[model samples]
Target: MYGNQWSTDGVVVARNGPSLVSYRFILKRSDDGKLFKCEAFDSEGESILESSVILEVFYIPKISFSPKQTLTVKENEQAQLICINDGNDQNATTIWKRQRTSTIVQNNCVLNFKNVKRTDAGLYTCIVDTKVGVYEDNARVIVLYAPTIDIEYFPSTKTMKCIPRGIPDSYMFKDWEHTTEYNDHLRFLATTKEGNNATLTIPQNVNKKDNNRERGIYICRASNNISSIDGTFAMQKYNLNLPGKPHFVSSTENTQYGIYLETTEIKIKFVSVPENTNYVVYKNGIKFTDYNESVLRNTKIIDTMYGKNVSVKGNILSLFVKLYTSEDFCWYKIAVKNVVGCSNYSIKLFSASLPGIPQILRAVPKQTEIAVLWNPGFHGGYHRWFIIEYRKVGDIYWSNQTTNSPNSTVIGGLQPVTIYLIRMFSRNRIHDSKRTEEILIQTGNVLMQ
Candidate 1:
């Protein structure tokens, strides 16, 4: 056995007796290339036998993470990770792959991602491979990204919602905005939220006054600590033609009649509230044919309740009638309708120049007086009165009686036993119309003696 004077560095030798020897040492990675020697000699210290041994140690690669802590990465950016080779064997090959799975990563110990996505976040393992065995450990990566937004419109609820998805499972609505075709911009203060989505409710009706705030696009903005994003929420348009009534504009009639033939033409102009739809025309309360006129194809704008502007057009209806008789006047009406409701405008086709003659004249004679009754006709667009004329038979002058009552009149102070002739006519502000047929009457004597 060698003596302790020749050995140190965690090495010990002992000789319990001349026939027994023992050696001990604690092996380490630094001792892989170190040499240990033992010699036996006579009592005079002559070299008898010598032997040496070289100690080689291989470690199981006590593995640890490169970052020693969790790694955090932003979405849609480049990322890379490394595994430090702290093993004594520098010739060992390095490998990287996903943890708890067989998905191996390329580029040896370094894990690389060009534009890492949200789905790429999870645990990754770094494996150090050597002839002895394989050593591995796990590391975590946290991917933080901006919010993603999607907008949905619900016609039944008259509402719009903005849905957002982001990392950290939290987000906020940044803006509620609007954009018009005319390049106008508007902002809304949105203070309401339900669950994880932001909602904007639409007004069922618009108050019409002007055309300043009409059809446009609605936008929703969502944001997180990383970034902000936007999406279209709704497109607003006004359809005043539904769930409302049509309006009356104006009406006109042109009439011409000879002794036999009469021709009447009517023109009625109307509009729908928020108007633009199919309409119907009526002649004497009966449905007439469609007369889709191109001359009145014009529209105007209306102010909405939310201060939006939209267009509504006026409609024109024309009806022409001809008959072989002179009394062929008519009543014309226009009706515009839709699924919401219906409305009408009407016109009485008649001339306003001269008042109509009285008809169905009746006379009741008494001893010294007479009474006349008649039915009235059209007023010719003016206030009218009836004139009754009476005279003795073969008399030159006729006495006149005026009555505003359309039904009857009375004449007193007539001579007894006298024959009389009478007639009636109607007069307006313009002039008198043609008189009715004459009637002959005889007054009775006093007491009929």
Candidate 2:
């Protein structure tokens, strides 16, 4: 029979012989044949015929591989491998080696690759052979760099877009800055999808803070699990203003029965007018009703039609010639006469003749009775009167009559066999003038006795 005891600190001994037995423990070294005492154990009780002993202790060092965490090196760069061993033993020597390389780098334990290619990537290990034992550890080394960008201009929105070179899982976008003073609250936006591409939009309406402001440079950094790249673009500015000049197209007059003769249809062509202004039309001295609406609210196309009346607000100053059926007539002395305190602007009707004598013109059939109508000039004065006079082709003494109203009378007119001259003059207290021209009448004997 044998007796055995074990301790919590990894020591065990057994006794069956008359003498006590003790055991020495050591860890094996890999690089060189060496051993160090890891633990020791001795039998405490008396031993009889046989005895056994066991001592267990582990020898481990603080070992680490070079380029500890992560690295970003350009392609074809010269990189170095450094192995470090932080343990209690100073006689320990480290061996630097890679999973793919068979040549073991010893002594200084520093591995240098003059030009590292992507194929030279692997798990680098550092093995330390010490007098006590062997220890080792490893780290993963990576080779990668940032990306470049190509930019193009989008004219429609006055924006610039940046395109990155490679596939990226995520991206970061930032506004460019010329100096250290930065306004981080730049109004910009960026969006991306899984496969296609990314885009950034700058709103059309920017606040006063961003008005007339240069679109600063923008940086786009794209990242995948293995690598990252960056691209940049310059800012752009947009202009917002109104359009220019206007032109006239065409005009017209209407002769529909019973419609006021001077009330005509006018067609005009022109450019778009800006909002908020008033447009008024005038015929002779009378205000026509072409445009009672505000110009700003009207969206009429250029070269459109409009209509208006000849007399507005009861003012009788006809400057425009009225086109009649199968005939064209020009009348003068179309003087707009007004009495005192009338406060109206008058269009001088020149007699179409001498020393400026006041006169009215008529185009009628010879020997036929004709009626003349005119608006009484703006009514304010004490006396409103018109004088009607006519002379035969060769007669010098004028047959004349006076009337208080704009309407007058003619009697015993001849047949369609003679040409007569008719004239009307308007008079007021302030001044007197002759008509613009004489009315021409040629009579025809169709129904005459």
- lDDT value, residue 335 of candidate 1: 74
Q: How do all models score by TM-score?
A: 0.50, 0.24
Residue 26, model 1, lDDT? 70
Query: How high is the lDDT of residue 404 in model 2?
Result: 78
**Residues 342-376 of candidate 1: C-alpha lDDT, one tens digit per residue:** 76766665554688888846898889888898888
Clashing pairs in 1: 206-305, 207-304, 207-305, 208-303, 210-303, 213-307, 213-308, 213-309, 214-308, 214-309
Q: What TM-score does prediction 2 earn?
A: 0.24
